[model samples]
Target chain A: MMRGKYVIAGIGHTAFGSLPGRSTISLNVEAVRNALADAGVEKDIVDAVLVKYPTSHFESIYGQKVAEALGLTPRINCVVDQAGASNIGMIGYAAMAIEHGQCEVALVSFADNPKTGSRAVFSRSRDPNAVFGWFGVPAGYAMVARRHMGEYGTTHAQLGAVAVACRRHGAQNLRAQLKKALTIEEYLEQPMMVAPFRRDDCCLVSDGGAAVVVMSRERARQLKVRAPVPILGFGQGHTAWDVAQRPDMTTTMAKASAATAFKMAGLLPKDIDVAQIYDCFTITALMTLEDYGFCKKGEGGHFVEGGGIEFGGRLPMNTAGGLLSETGMPGLQLVLEGVRQMRGEAVLQVPHARTSIVSNQGGVMHTHATLILGQP
Target chain B: MTDDEKAAALRPPADPLGDQFWQSLKEGRLTFQRCKHCGNAWLPVRSECPRCLEADWAWENASGAARLISWVVYHRAFHEAFADRVPYTVAVVELTEGPRMTSNIIGAGDPEALKIDQALRLVIEPDFGLFVPRFTPV
Candidate 1:
C-alpha cells in the first residue's frame, strides 16, 4: 500500500474539439502552462514530464521531443505507452518517481490531433492477426459485444444506457466534443458501424490536450498548494498485445488492475464516491464496470440500465461525458475530471464527493489502469 | 479482385516464422505449428511455443474442420483498403486441431444467420493473385 504521499496538485484541460490551428506540441504547451498556473508552481520546479507515446512519430524520439519542447530537462523523463491506460499509468509512475527520490514535481500530460491530422493511431505492426482480417477497434469491439451478448444476454439497449448517460454528462461541459444529449431512441436509431455497434455507441474523434501536475505530499505542503488531490493508489494490468489472442473476450485486465488498486488503497468498490471510467465505446464502459467489480461479471449491461450510471444514480460514472461524449483525446482527461471531482471543481460535480476512482482501458481492450484518488 | 485485394490476400507480412504457415495455406492446407518438444499447437505462427518457450517447432496440417467463436459484419470501413468490401464478414474460428484464426466465413448467405460453435470447413480462395484461406459452413 502507498503512504498516500503523492498529490495531483493541479489539473488542466483545453477545449476538447476540432481546432486545426493547434499542433500536438502547442496544445500540450497550453495544457502544461495552465497546469503550472493551477499549481502555483513555476515551470522551472518541474523536474520531470511524462506523456503518452506518440504513435504519429515514425521514430522513437517521442519522449525526447516532448520533454525538450516543455523544457522539462531532467535525469528522469520518458513516454508511458500503455495506450488508453497511459494516463493513469503515468500518474502511478510519477508517484513512484517521487517515492524513489528521482524528481520532486512531475508534469503528466497528453495531446493529440487525430481528427484534423492523420488518424494513424491503429495497429501498424502488420502482424499475422492484422493482415488476417482484423478490421480495427470497432470491429474488434463489435466481436466482443456479440460474445457478451451470447454469453450474458447483454443487449443493445443496455449498451445504449451508457451512451445516453455520457451524452447527458457531456451536455453540461463546455469543453466536451459532442454536447447534444442522446436518447435511447437516437442511440438505437443510429446507423450501424458494425453489427452490435451503432455510430452513436462509439466515441467521437477530436483534437485536444490535458495535463496534471503530480508531486509528493511533502512537496505540495512545502509549496503550500491548494486542495491537493492525493493519489491513494493505482494499479495496471494487461491481457494481450494482440487483440485476437485474448483468453476471454468479455473480461479485460481491468479486473486485476482494480483488485490491486483497491488493495493498495485499502479501499473497496463501494468506497468510491464517483467514477470516471473510460468510455471509448459504450460496450467498453459496460465491460469495465463489470471488470472493476462495480457489478457482477456479465451484469454490466444491466448495471447501467435505468439511469444507473447517470447523474444522481447510485454510482455516477464518466461524469465528464467520457471519450464517448468528451473529446477523444485519450484517457488522461478522465484523470483530470476525477481530480476536479476531488477538488469539488468538476463541471458535473458529484455532490460532496470525497473519494473517486478513474479507470482507463487501452489498446484493443488490451491494457487497463485503475487509480483511487481522494482529498488529503 | 482488385490489386489491393490481391495484395491483401497475400501471406501476411513477410516473416520467417509465418512463412511456413502461409505457404501451407497457399498449398491448400491449413497448418499450425506444434512444439517439437511439447505438442502445444498455436495459430498465427509464433516463433516459439508459449507453453515451453521452445523455439523448435514443426508445421502440422489441420483436418480443415473448425467452429465459429465470433464474427462481425462491417457496415463501415475503417480502412480505405477494405472500403470496397464493405459489409464483408470476418470471423474468428477455432480449428478442430486447437488453433484459432481470423478469416472470412463464406457460404453463410446472411451474416446474421451464422451461429456460434457452428461447424465450418476450410476454403482456399484466390484474392487478386494471392491465395487466402476462408471458411464455409459445413
Candidate 2:
C-alpha cells in the first residue's frame, strides 16, 4: 500500500493570531481560495471536501458548511476528527478517496475562532474519574511531564529549552503571533499554568485557519506551479480516550503511527530533514520526540538541550514556530509548515530540506497522526 | 445565566455507568471492578471487563494503599467554582490493587511535596454533594 498516488498540491493560511472580526467561515473561505489558487486548480475541479474537527463551540457540520460557503458542490464531503491530530487524518482520508477513484482533487481545510469563541475544555462531558480537578489541556500534559520527570529525571530547564527554541524560530516567522525572543531563564520565569508546565510552555490561543490541496501525483505534475510535495506516507493512531486509561502516560500512540508512516514511505528517522511535531506543551513535544523515535526513551532532554532542536541543529523542529508560538490551530499548521519546508519557502528553512515529517495529537495524548512528505 | 456562567455552573456529574463507584466512595471505601472470569481489576468501572470483556464482575474495595505516579499544581482556575481555589495540586496515584486514578494529593498543595513511588493512603472527601477519592502521603 505504498502511496506515491497522492501529493500535497498547495497550502494556504490566514494571519495566524487573534483577529477579532474573523469568523470560521470567512477564515475558511480565505484559506480555501488561497489553496486553490496555489494549486492552480479551479474550484469546480475539487470534487471532495475534508476538514479538521474543531474544538470550537461555534461551528457544526463543518465540511458541508465550508463547501457551501465556498459555493462548491463536492462529490464527497466530511469532517474528520482526531482532536488536534485531525489534519493528517484529513490528508490520509483525502488520499484514500483519490485511490478509490472517488475524487481527483480534494481540498482540506481547518479554521477556528478560538480566541473569539467561547472557552471550554476538550471533553464534552466530564468523567466522574476526573472530578478532583482537571484544568483542561495544560493539566493533562502536566501529568505526563511529572511522570517523565519522576521516571527519567527530566528537568524544568530541559522543558524550558523547547519553549526557547520555538520562540527563537517564531521570532523570524512574520505570521507567528508571538515573535519575541525568549531565553531558557525567561521561559522558566513565566507563570505556571500547571505544575511542570509554565505559561510559555503552552501553545498560543489564536484565531485562524489553514488549508491544503491534495490530488494525485499525476495531476500535480500537470499544474503550472513547481512540483508538489509527494505524500510519501500518512497514518493515524487512536488510543485510550481518557488519560487514566492510557497504557503508559509517558509514551503515546505516535510509536505505532510513525512506524506505519515510515514503513509506507520506506524511510528511516534519519532521512527526515525537518519535523513539525505538535507543541501544545513543551513536555508533549519532548515526549513526542521520544515516542516518534527521534531519540532514545528518556533522552529527549539530552537530545534537545545542546541547541540541537534549533534551526541549525540535529533536527530542526516546529519550523513554523509550531502551536507553541505560531498559532494554536493544532494539526493543520504542522502540515502547512511541512509543505512549506519541502518547497524551500519556510521563514526558518532547514537547509536543503527535501524530506519532512509532521505529527499532531488530540485529547490527552489520546489520538496521534504522523505524516511524511518529500520531493515529487 | 450567560453561556460562560452556565459552563461554569456545570460540575463533574456522575453518570449511571459510574454510579457504583460514586456510592462506594460515599461509603468511605475505594472500590474497583474485578472480573470473576479472568481476575483482572479496573477502575471507573465499566459494565464489561476490559481485559477479558466479560460482564461477570465483582466490586472490591482497594487496600487504600497507593504509590504516587505523578502530580501537578494548577495555578489557574479552569472553572468559576474553582476560581478561588487556584493553585491546587492534583496527582495520579496507582492503587496497590493495580489501578490508577486522578485525585488530589492533600497537604501536598505544593508540587515539591510529591515523590514518585512514595506511599500514600486514600481519603474520601465530599465535593458538590459527591464524595470523591483523594490521596495523601502515608
Candidate 3:
C-alpha cells in the first residue's frame, strides 16, 4: 500500500503451549504454511527464508532443518543467531532485502520447545566459565534485579507491578500462559526462584512458533489483499554479552536500538501508538520502559506501578500479553502481536493504533533489536 | 594442591567449543573465534561465521591484553550459583583484535574502582574444573 517500503502481507502462529507429540519441524511447517495461505502467496513465491532460534543447546541446524521441512530446501536462507532478538532482526533483514530487490518475498519464522527436558537454562557445555554453570535464566535476571534494587532503590513491590500489568494484559489474550490477575501481595507471596524475584516475576517456558510473510511494497499492492503494514525503521544494539559486564543492569541496550529506530522513522517515543517490548522477565520490561525513553531512568519502577501499561495508559504495551504471561514462543510472538495491533485486528486492540515499536533482547543482557512498523 | 593446580582445576573440560579456549586461558592467553571470510571475531564460539555464513575459521590467540570498555557491579546475587560472589564486577574488555568480550573483573578490592578504557590483562582462574578467563587491572 505504501510506496518504497516493504510490508507484512500475512502472519501465522501456532498455539503457544506445550505439545509433546509435535516436533520442531511440524511446528515450523504449520506456521509457514498457514502464513503463505493467509497471504495468498504460493510457496514458490518466497525468494528467501530467515529462520531464527537459539540452537546452540538444540542439535538441529536451524536454517537447513526448517528449509527442508518447508519443502523449500536449497532456497536462499540464513539462520539468525542473535538469540531472542533473532526474529526481530530477521524481520528487519527481510524488509531490507525486499526493498533492495534481493528478495521479493521472505518468510521469517521462530519456534522453541523450552519446557521439556530441554536445557532452557544456561548450557553447561557451551558456556562453562563464570558462576552460572548450574544457574538458569531466572538466576541471571535475578542478579540484574538485585543490582537494580541496590543502585536505584527498585523494590520487589514495583517488580510485582510489572507482573500485574502483564497479567492484566494477558487476561485479554486467549493465548497467554498465565491469565489470572496478580496483586502485589499475592505476587510477593509466590515462591522465590531467587531473592527479590518471585516465581511470577519470571516468564513461563512453553512451546510455539510464529511466522510472518514480508513482500516488496509493489508485490503487496499487486496481491490486492488487505493493506499491509510497512516497516518504517529498525535498529540493534548491545552492551556486553554476560551479566557481569553490563554497565548498569537497569540501562538496557534497547535505548540504543530505540533511538536509532525513532530517528530512522522520523518519530519519537511520543509518536508511537503501542509497544511490544520483550519481557522474558518482569524486570526486563521495567528496564525497557526506561531505556526506550518512555519514562525517565530509575522511574521505571514507579511508571509501571499505576498500571500504566494497561489500556488507556500513557502507552499500551504487550496488548496481546507478552512473554511474561503470553506463550513463551520467545519474543517473536511479540512481533507478530505488534503487527496484529497495527492492523487493528488485535484481540485486545488499542484504539486507533497506527504505529508500533517491537523490541526483543537476546542472550543474557546483550543483543537488542527494535523494529518500528506503521500504516500511513 | 599447589596454586597452579588449583587454578587449573577451574578450567572447563575439553569440549569441541571450549577445548582450545581453555587451553589458551591456561597459558594466560585470551582466544576467540575469527571468521576467515568476514574478518569478524566473536567470543562464545559458533560453528560458522554469523556474518558470512562460512564455517571456515580458526581460534586466534591473543596477548591476553585489552582495555575495559564498560562494566557493572552486582551487589546482590540473583542466581543461586553467584550467591557468594555478591558485589562482584563484570566488564566488557575491548580486545586488541577489534572485538569485545564479557568477563569478570577480579584482583580489585572494590567494584567501584573499575574505569572505562582502563588497561587490563587476562587472568585465567580455575573455577571448579573449568579454567575461566577473567580480567584484572594491568
Candidate 4:
C-alpha cells in the first residue's frame, strides 16, 4: 500500500490571470523552476516528470516538450489527462510508481492560457446537442443546478452563498485573480449568462501554471525538504457519461472517490479541518460537499448557507479562493492550497489545521479525484 | 441568409452510424435503439448496447411521448451560428419509452413556464437541410 508513504515536497505556480505574451511552455518551466527551488533539490534529482496536458489545446509529445524545456532527461516521462482531475490523480500515480520501483521523485505540473488563448474552444458546438443550442460548459452545470433546485428545493440564494464565500476569501489573497468581495445581493444582481448561473457562479478563465513535487518519505527526509506534506491518501473515480445519460444529476463520482481516500486515510469528514473542494461552478461545490458526506445528500444547499463554508464555519472551504475566485487553471492550485494549509503557511490559515482534503473534478462531473494531506 | 441556408448551417456533420436515426426523422419518425438481449433503450446512436454490451440491437420508433427532465436558458450564444438565437431553451427530455436525449422545448411562451416531468410530444420540424426532432407541451 502506498498510503502515507509519499510526501509532496514542493509546490509552485506562476502568476495567474492574463499573461498575454508568455507561451504555455514558458509558464510551465517557470512553475517547475519555482517548485525545484521550493523543494531545495537539484534538477537532476527529479527522475520522473508527469504533466497534465494543457486544456486549451493539444500538441504531440506535450510532456516531452515540457521536459525538454526544463532540460531534464527523467527516467519516467508522460502526460496524463483526466481534465481537471489530472493533477491529484497524477500525484497518486507518482506514489504508485515509486512504490513499484519504476521511478522516484516525480514532478507533476499543469499550465494553460485559456484566458488569452482561444476560449472559443469552450464554446464549440457539442455534437448532437449543439443543434438544440446547448453550448459551453456552463449550460451543463446550469442544467444540473436547475435539476438540483427541482429535486431538493435548492434556491438561487443558496447557490450564491458559495460564490460569496470564495470571493470573500479571495479578496484577502493578493495573488488571487479576482480579489473583489461579493455579497449575496450583489451576486443576485449579476446577469444570468445561463439560467441558474450568473457570471459570479462560474469559474474565472485564467492563464497560468502550477506544479508540485512528490517523493518517497525517506527521500524527503534525506533531502531535508522544507515542510513536506504527507500524502495520507489519494483516490479517483470517473463516471464517463454525458450529463444527459447520467441516471441521476445531483449525485456525482465524488462519492466513490472520497470513499476510497477516506478509507485509505482511516479518516472521516468531521476529522478534516480544512477543505479545498473544486468550484468549477457553485453547484459542483455544493453537490460535491453532499457527495463527500460533509452533509446529507440534497441538503448541501442549507449546509453552505449562512457562512457555513466560510472561515469559522463548520468546515472551512476553499481557503485560497478556489476555482471560483482564484486561477481557473483546472485544479492543481487547490492542491497547492492544501499543501499550504497543512504546512501552516496559508494566506488565510485555518487554525491548527491538522488535516486538509482537496478534491478535483472535471468534465461536468464525469471525473473526480480526492487527496488527503496531513502535516509532516 | 435564406431560412434554409441558416438551418443548413446548423446541420451537424453526417455520421454513418447515426444516419438511420436522422433519416428516420426525415421520414417523419423519431427512433432510439433497444437492446435485443436486455430490453434496454438509448439515444444518439451507439454501436453496442450500453447496458449489456451486446451488438445485437434494433431501432425502435418512439411514440411521440416524452417528459421534461431539466432545461437551461442561454442568455448568450456560444456558437456563432446561434448568434441570432440567444435566449433560447435547451432541455433534456426522457421519452416515455425509457430513452432520454438532449432537445429543445418549443411553443412554451416563457421558458420559466416549463417544469420538470411536464408531458411533451415529439415534433419533427424542418431545419435548413434536414428534419430535426423537438418537443412541445402536450
True contacts kept of 4: 0.80
Separate clash counts for every candidate: 1, 0, 11, 1
For every prediction, compared with the true complex, DockQ reads 0.57, 0.60, 0.10, 0.79
Per-residue lDDT of A281 in model 1:
83
Question: Could you arrange the candidates by TM-score from highest to lowest?
Answer: 4, 1, 2, 3
Point out where model 2 deviates above 4 Å.
A58-60, A122-126, B1-11
lDDT of 1 by residue, A115-207 (tens): 787776552323465444565667777888887887898888999999999999999988888989999998888877788789887788888
- Compared with the true structure, all predictions reach lDDT values of 0.83, 0.83, 0.75, 0.91
lDDT of 1 at A8: 93
Candidate 3, which segments miss by more than 4 Å at Cα?
Answer: A1-4, A54-61, A73-75, A120-126, A130-134, B1-11, B14-138
Model 2, span A1-376: residue lDDT tens: 6467789998888888778988888898899888888887788888999987567753578789889999989998998877888888888888988899998899889888878775564423235534576657778788889889988989999998898888899889888999997998787778777777888888888889899999888887776556588989987778765776665778878889999998999998899999998998888889889988889999999988978999999999998788888898878888988998888888887889989999988877889999999965
Q: Clashing residue pairs in candidate 1, if any?
A: B6-B128
What are the interface RMSDs of all the models?
A: 2.4, 2.3, 6.6, 1.2
TM-score, prediction 1: 0.96
Q: Report the C-alpha lDDT of model 2 over B1-138, residue by residue, as the tens digit.
A: 454554435545656757767777788888988899999988766799889999998999899999888888878777555666678887777899998787888865456757888999988887656777888888
- Tell me the TM-score of each prediction against the true structure: 0.96, 0.95, 0.75, 0.98
Let me know the TM-score candidate 4 reaches against the reference structure: 0.98
Deviation (Å) of A329 in candidate 2 = 0.5
Ten-residue region with minimum lDDT total, candidate 2 chain A: A121-130
